[model samples]
Target chain A: MPPFSRFTALTEQLPASVPFVGPEVQERQAGTPFMARLGANESGFGPAPSVIAAITEASATVWRYGDSESFDLCSALARRLDLPCEQIIVGEGIDSLLGLTVRLVVETGTPVVTSLGAYPTFNYHVTGYGGRLVTVPYRDDREDLEALRDAVLREDAPLVYLANPDNPMGSWHSADAVTAFARSLPDTTLLVLDEAYGEFAPDGVLPPVSDLAQLPNVLRYRTFSKAHGLAGLRVGYVFGTAETVARFHRVRNHFGVNRLGQVAARAALEDAHWLDHVRAQVAAALQRLAQIAEQNDLQPLPSATNFLAIDCGSAVRARSILEGLNAHRVFIRMPGVAPLDRCIRVSAGPASELDAFEKALPTVLAGLT
Target chain B: MPPFSRFTALTEQLPASVPFVGPEVQERQAGTPFMARLGANESGFGPAPSVIAAITEASATVWRYGDSESFDLCSALARRLDLPCEQIIVGEGIDSLLGLTVRLVVETGTPVVTSLGAYPTFNYHVTGYGGRLVTVPYRDDREDLEALRDAVLREDAPLVYLANPDNPMGSWHSADAVTAFARSLPDTTLLVLDEAYGEFAPDGVLPPVSDLAQLPNVLRYRTFSKAHGLAGLRVGYVFGTAETVARFHRVRNHFGVNRLGQVAARAALEDAHWLDHVRAQVAAALQRLAQIAEQNDLQPLPSATNFLAIDCGSAVRARSILEGLNAHRVFIRMPGVAPLDRCIRVSAGPASELDAFEKALPTVLAGLT
Candidate 1:
């Protein structure tokens, strides 16, 4: 049957494609579950016992809608981030927040700037809002700040996205460099500073909140999905100047965040010990993964995040290695663009999962030639 | 201190008002929790025990992102509804789905039709997307379907909304009447038939799946928030022709639904015995509420859903009664517009909450003059 014919012209022109086909879809297609799930950069170490306890406790109270204001969670986040509650706006997840952010600034044909192969979800939202995307390529496997600034000025883009301790490549810039880049942007441009992996980065890798707190043009986003291991719960927040963040109140899904997510996130925030434990475990796993890469005669790119990007020499070789590992029922991902696609990205997980990857790599690589 | 100056013109013109200020906000302002929660129409009977078990069981697996496609939940809903999986789209909630539907059909100055004050959340989304709403006043306290269709034709509107077993009034029209209304609208005017209270409504009040299944312009929205008592989990869905539902895939946040919500919803759908039990309890509670209204010399409207609307003679009297009940820590709501505001709305809950409401009504009525 013909579809509803009244959708907006913009909707008609948009492609019905998603940013990523989830691993579960792959498992269903292959008719088998992967032995090792190392894609998506999820913390398979799992949420803290305290967080799990909180979720279980909150399960019975699931009849009441979550706080539309998310008052308590925001109050708790404010104390931790040293920002006033008015400067924070919580939503379903960073992806949802990114969509709202784009909707606030973009109209048809409005220019948006970002790294070419950076977070596809961000790009998806930009296009979904009918914004014109202006992309800059990465330099030395890192988001090139100078090129991004140049593109923003050239295109007069209203928005730009940057993820620190970057995705797919697992690289990062020092706090000084990031702050300098933010200061260099025009006031008319809003920078979406994504720090989803900030918890796993080294101490000096993330800029102090106060460093950019004075700028209305900068909004920093963080999530419980990464370090806290609550990806499935869907809670993320963005903080900026109080005046700037209040704009989100104009368009956000007020009751979007789930009740158990609020409970789990608040408990996760209070558990410093578990966070430290996950950090140490991730560090050790990254080290082990580097060794495995070296043993296979591959170069492991340095990462300040919980994943390693091992260069497989060429894009074709990387593709073959990825397919071979998939044949062995091990799930992992590679970047989408040229130079970056030469490496395979693996998230830090439990030892057993890593052991599965370790066992599968040799046979896969041996068959690659 | 200024908000970022680069937000779009539409964003600037939009007000920062929310649809409903949650009861939690009121409790915070009152400096105490309510003795009873009869507002927001939440199920105080809570989710089924089996559903809670499912949530607790799934809590540990939250480290993994929920399946972006919502394959299992959609598959289960398809089986229960006897529709193809491709015809359904699961989302964060009906509120979120409403927003997406408006986005797909609306642009600046686009005309949309609905009853005045029918559902503020739907109005909020229409205005957020810059749609011009053409409203028809309710006739005799029920949605004036003939007037709504007239407005759609008059405005050449692309969208219209109707909530069955309506909120704030607890009144309904027969399935045949609703089907006739849907058939009268032009194919270009998509109908958002909200069935949030469908589970609580009397059986013959809802249209059978096959009644309007062939109309690409009609979509039905249902939720677990009411009869299934999973409001805090944020799971709602829309079903239409397979071709029409595919448009949501172009713009929806792929991973928006939470993992525990999907698990709880699946379990709730399967627990037919529990649903029947909840429906029986709600029937009893509604009877008790009607009696309580009569004891206070008020008129209780006939209801097919799980709430009672009692007329207090005038808007001023209704406002006074609502304030008095609030002072007694018994939370309830009133309609927003003129003739409808003459009544107060109370949701059916557990017996203890009903007892609190029953006790408070006499004192509130005595002070109303």
Candidate 2:
């Protein structure tokens, strides 16, 4: 029999496809696990021992639902960030939170502005909500902030997304530039400022909380999945003006954040020393990765994020290298669009994984030559 | 200054209210923890030792994102249910799945049918999507199946919701009657068959998998939160025809299900002996609760779920008893609407928790009288 006949027109038009293919799916098809798991920008240095301990301790109480308000975790984050708890909203992750943000603003034919090849999941959400995407292409391996601003005005878009220390290309804008860009948007246009890589960026790169905390039209998103190494737990938060953040309560899944995630995230926040340790490890790994790239005659881009995007000179070479890496059981990803597609993105991990990547890259490039 | 000026009209119309106030919030308000948690229908018997072991074992790998496909858990569920993996969709919980279903089918002013005091979270999702709700009042403490069918036909609703072995009033319909009710709906009207409590119900009370598996309009949702006792992990699933289930992929948060939740749920499913133990405990707890109600001169309603809904003879009396119990540090809940509001609901827990409830009941009842 055919499927139910009365799905919304928007739902009917949506393609049955996921944003990114998970490494596990690739493993299943390849009949083996990847030797070096550096894809998808996950932190392989692992969460703090305290966070893991918290999760283990909390497992016995798995029968009780999490606090619907996420009060304890929110309070902990508020204390750490020096923001009022009312200004923060915790969610399953930045991905689910992005979907919620899209749902709240986008209706059929609503124009949403975003950079081309920035984050496919954000584009997926906009299209799922029937929002017409207005794309601004990257200029010089960076999210072209000026072009994005121009498109928002041209399309009169209510929503615009910008990820600083951006994905696929590990480029970043100065804190002053980002602040000026956010200030430029009209009051009617809400800027979804994704700072997923904020923790890894240098001091001058990220805007202070006080700089954008009071902006009603800006929502800053951050995640524990990156530097804190809790991607598997799926915990993230968005903070904005209290009045604006209140809207999430209207439509959020009240008990969506799991109990263990809440516990793990709170513990992660308290462990400042562990975060510093991961940062040092990531920095060293990135240096090693750059040396490997230089040794293989590839250009490594300057990075503010945990991952480095190496220039393979051409899209064809990049594609060939990605495929060859897969064949060697080295899982890595690359940009989806052109120009930027000339680079392959690799995340920082332990020395052993980097050794695997180093051993595989020379052979892959040789094969390509 | 003010909030962002351009949230969608549906979002503006939505009130910033959650479906249920969690017991944790109340404990904070009261500045003390409840002595016994018998509300929210959470299984206090805890997850199986095997499930906890799985969560603990998997906690060390918290850096990796869960498989977006949820292949392992889905495969396990398929083997157990004798349904193809293509027919299953795993989500954070039934709440998240319900929201996705509403988003798929309901648009602005789209007619949707459900019982008056059924799952408020489902209604929240419908309203969040701007669906017009057509409520059928419960008949004889159960969902009025015929009345629901009439309303669906009359309003041409694209969606209808029913929770068999229902919530708020722990009553259920026979499997044959439920099958007839599902078959009665028009092909255009999709039925959200919530079976969160299915594991606790007697064998014949739930429709056999084959009876409704092929019906494109009927989707069955079950959870690990109830009988399997993993509410805090936030795992649930929906199964139907392959084509219908495939629609979830279009909008689902690809990595929303956490890694440990997947592992824990799979372990819970494999431990059949633990589930049987929980069932036997629930049966005994329900009997004990009924006896306590009878001793307090209240009428205990027949229940097919893990909770008992005792009729307090009037809504005012029920409300008074609930307040009095709160004063005694017992956490329980009641229905939100009339007739059903004449009862107070209590979940089955361990003997120590039941002892706390037993000690508090008579005094609260005497004060109410």
Candidate 3:
């Protein structure tokens, strides 16, 4: 069982861990399936009918490997984003893209800046690359843009990560503020703008794709996992200047993106009507979740993403609810680190699942009382 | 459009080129679809009905990211391979796994060894991670095992790559020779045994999975992309000592493997009947292709793979016939270097597609004349 003694020093020093425990893993551990599967911020509404049809059609052609270049999908994305095709690089997900971006700049002991408990996946990549993490605490439950900018300059870091309409907290900075924050970063630093949930963000929360396209240091990523509801497909893309995205081609698995993902993503993009409908449904679900929180004397933070961070008043209380829900077969996740962990994160689910959450919360909390 | 000036020197120097050009790209350039889609070594026979059923049923679950741990798929694979679940780590593909392996061991200017014109993706990853490639030419259409071992020792390489049932030329070394190669390497040097087409190789051509499992220095890769007819799903897994597989955890995109791929691979593993059928078909097609090569006054090399490389007397003649096939809407590929490029490589397809090849080869050759 001895490991090859020759792995890079950084890899040997790292511990085996994952950024998030998948709901499936929870089900296996709990030995019971969740009554409500809203933990991972995946759209329970599912992909459009058209997307399903496309997938079924592609199932026959699954023998041929997907285009390593991701040509058609990138072309489609470029047209949609109003950027040239050269500016885009498709990947397995924003998670993979983050790892690639980190590898491009981070080396042993390299300083990388991000909010303390933002996207654990980004931090995982930084640590994987042997980069020292410099974290700025969240301010007012939002990624503190001013502090992040300061940290980048103070550390003279080469990499900075921010997620707009952020995960876990589901709070966001305005597009104008993000633009200013990106502009403020040193030219030596690469800014990774993770907008995995941009399709569900409120108006003015996402800047125009062109807004950051020309910045050599900025890489903005988006995914079909959110409103498009094809998360199981694992297709997301990053776009910036041709030179910026071109670097991805050098290190990327040209065939990394799967064929099912490519077909589903293309179909999802063409299903504009379905996107609008899903967005409306997500908005409604957010409202319903907020109402459920209000009824329970819990504070639901403002959300511009598919999930809401419900304030349970303290981290201990939030932990209790999370454990209780899992015991009750209601799978949910919270932010890993405090103070973000004080708020239990719940994703928008269909009415049936939300109803299960509504029915279970009071009883679980009452038993605690 | 300039890229950032601060990229790692390795990233800056790596070329924008990729390993494989997708058949779709070739079709686009050909301005016509192929009559016989026999390139890239895909199974035109397609997957089993049960596998497609699995994919369709899994569509409703596409909203969730695949299990980051990929436990179920790994367990299924372990059972299939008679290994423990801990021994297998599924990845986006063999291509992606190779990249991770390189990242684990390779630093700038780290020496790496492979056959000249071996799998380009492996070379890409080595160059990507700043590993210097030392290539040994094939001997009598087979990877020169002695030269590879000598290079590994002389260059003090930490990593080496070998593909059984090699691509660009469908050649294979005996399983005994392969085991000897793995045993001959230094314990500090890791051997990436790429067995992508192992299923097509004769029984004695691939070493047993357990043969090299005890060698912490050895990792074997297998994929559903070829004989199993799931290439587009992008599922490839590597099995090594638990120690080496553990290193993948330090950097793998846990959710990088898509949901459908996980399900399809699990389903394919369950369908032993389909695998047997495809193997027989591939063998017969190789026979048919050989006969056609003789009809064209070319020598077809003995193949342990789904494709055959016919010696067309010269590299120029091979290129002319390959180009003529494309002009005839009969898609095929050839090796890139001399000796190998003197042969045209063709994959097996369904009867009708093979019939297209049977009909078109003579006319295309006549047109060349």
Best by DockQ: 1
Model 3 interface RMSD over true interface Cα atoms: 1.3
Q: CA shift at A36, candidate 2, in angstroms?
A: 0.8
The residue-by-residue lDDT of candidate 2 on B23-140, one tens digit each, is 9999999999999999989999999999999999999898999999789999999998899999999999999999999999999999999999999999999999999999999999
Full candidate order by DockQ, most accurate first = 1, 2, 3
Itemize residue pairs with steric clashes in candidate 1: none
True lDDT of residue B52, candidate 1: 94
Instruction: Rate residue B39 of model 2 by lDDT.
Output: 93
Where model 2 places Cα greater than 4 Å from the true spot, the runs are: none
Residue B81, candidate 1: C-alpha displacement in angstroms: 0.9
* Model 3 chain B weakest 10-residue run by lDDT: B1-10
CAPRI grade, predicted model 1: high
Query: Model 3 over residues A243-279: C-alpha lDDT tens digits?
Result: 8888887777887888989989999999999999898
TM-score of each: 0.99, 0.99, 0.97
Q: Report backbone clashes per prediction.
A: 0, 0, 1
What candidate 1 gets wrong by more than 4 Å, as runs, is none
